[model samples]
Target: MTTWLLYGATGYTGKLIAQEAVERGMRPLLAGRSKEKVQPLAEELGLAFRIFELNSQTAEHLEDIDLVLHCAGPFEKTSKPMIHACLKAGVHYLDITGEISVFEYTHSLHEEALQKNIILCSGVGFDVIPTDCTALKLKQALPDAVELALGFDSDSGISPGTMKTMVEGLGGGNTVRKEGQLTDAAIGKHQRLIDFGRGKKSAMAIPWGDVATAYYTTGIPNISAWIPTPKAAIYAARLLNAASPLLSSEKVKQPLLKWVEQGVEGPNQEQRARSAAYIWGQAANADGVIKTCRINTANVYDLTVYGALEVTQRLLTGDYPSGSWTPAALFGPDLLESLPGSGRFEIDSFYPGNAN
Candidate 1:
């Protein structure tokens, strides 16, 4: 049987994935930088475990591992090292990352991954799967699509790791793909009323991973992603944008990160069971033709568990193409519907009244 390793196996989302993986009868080697955390989980699950920080010796640890499902983040820091190690070791790489830089970086390694005959798939989680798939679906519906917009809203709580990643991204403000290039937009500069299957809500464009991945998935020249935001948070985002340097500083970020560490563990079981996430996307062509789609799924973290494992199970079969790929690029838009709690995509196409 093909075997794999689960790094960051003790994290909140990782623990859920680990437990579910065991319940599904797979014995992945549990791993993380901290033996204190990783070992206990391995013991509890009765699975093999390993401890190793991301470093030059990382590839040495993958000798017996066929694939790696990396749950560690902020992946902007953690992904490169593991990816380098995976490339060297000829092991397939997958991660639940939604970070734009990480996705672009991994995409840069596409040729190397293809050369090594190992798949480098990122954003396997809620990060981009639903939106990425939506982008593809929209593109398919309107083959001439030149523009894409995607937004998601959820009542789910954030994890400390995710919080830290967001903090680290404060310096980036907002980003969107414009005419095939990444363009920075000021925070709160791009707001839209998106109906994410739950009435129209005010959403602000953010530096979502789809600003990178959706372009790759759909070959659309323009793209943006948004999330519902209140007026107060929008004001704060604008202030943070002006204070980007402070947020980028370790001295300034440490305290906030520490608070997240102590106080934020992400949603509990009940929250995971009840919370749902909605994704909305649209594509437009020069002719003013529009295509739209929406997906409702389990909470982002819960979807991550299913999405990661779904990709993991498929990669284990050794049937997927070997190259860096977004989920939609690898599995088609249907992959989103395949998730355990995902609702079928609701799609519509029409010509705007303003169309010439």
Candidate 2:
């Protein structure tokens, strides 16, 4: 009888998670900043609803829940308050943020969560599950790996929430891990042609959460994560990098935020059903031995629902270690095997001295 609470239950992605949770016969208490928004969804799903701004008072609303699935983001602003609330209430906290800063901040709470004896897991979604598991599998294949590269391509459409988050960090630059340290690099500084078992596509380095999560998961000292993009987008990113000072200014960013507001909510069911995602990872050691693999998963949004729910259910079963954890770190590499239609292929040609 593990009762759960879902914050930000009115957003595009949050709605999807709620719908899926209901379909699976789990009733989560819906919560958000606006009772007007959450009330309708809660009524529609026949679940309880609560309204509370994310702050010190948030814990007061968590009286009856065992866990909280935080869907609110840009987590940079929302996570800290919600996490503090969860810590104070002694409730497990989980989130779907891909923001590396959020991950690091949450990880910083490991000792506090352990002291409270509650699990604190983040990136329990498409953000890093597939890539996190793939990175761990590659590490298993190349146990002595010193460097790791991971990339992913998704056909899923962007939600307004995702767009807003991306826009907020427009000129932050890309990040990569070097010798176990996070280093900032100019956007579009590293581009590669990655073949995700489908075909070659142009991929550019991004400050993905895996750069931080994988370091803790496998202890890989050097890591990079990429997302496929068009050539024009790469060039545009470079231009933006050069003009970051202007583009990042409030004068410029304000208009961009307005533009993003008019965008679509996210992929519709038909679009989500038609979409597919692919992930690739390579692990190499100083001696030149490399192990590469590709993972083919269903739609990104759909996978997010699946991954999040799976983690939620696992938490409900109890006995998990208390700490901030990445998906692979808590569940292991084979966790993806439970995902329907998810397949992994290890390239036999990727081996010692191949260097390709």
Give the candidate number with the greatest lDDT.
1
lDDT string, candidate 2, 1-356, tens digits: 78999898998889999999999998888999898899999999999988889877888888778999999888888999999999999999999889999988988888999999988888988888999999999888888999999988878899888888888887899999999999999998899898876889888999999999999899999999988888899998898888888867888777878988775579899998888888898888888777778889988888888888889988998578997888899999887768765886565335554545
In terms of lDDT, model 2 sits at: 0.88
What is candidate 1's lDDT per residue for 276-356, written digit by digit as tens? 998899998998888888889989998998999998998887498889999999999998899999999888778877533
- Candidate 1, run of 10 with poorest lDDT: 347-356
TM value for model 2: 0.96
Best by TM-score: 1
How many residue pairs clash in model 2?
A: 0
Q: List the residue pairs that clash in candidate 1.
A: none
TM-score for each candidate, following the candidate numbering: 0.97, 0.96
For model 2, name the residue pairs that clash: none
What overall lDDT goes with each candidate model?
Answer: 0.90, 0.88
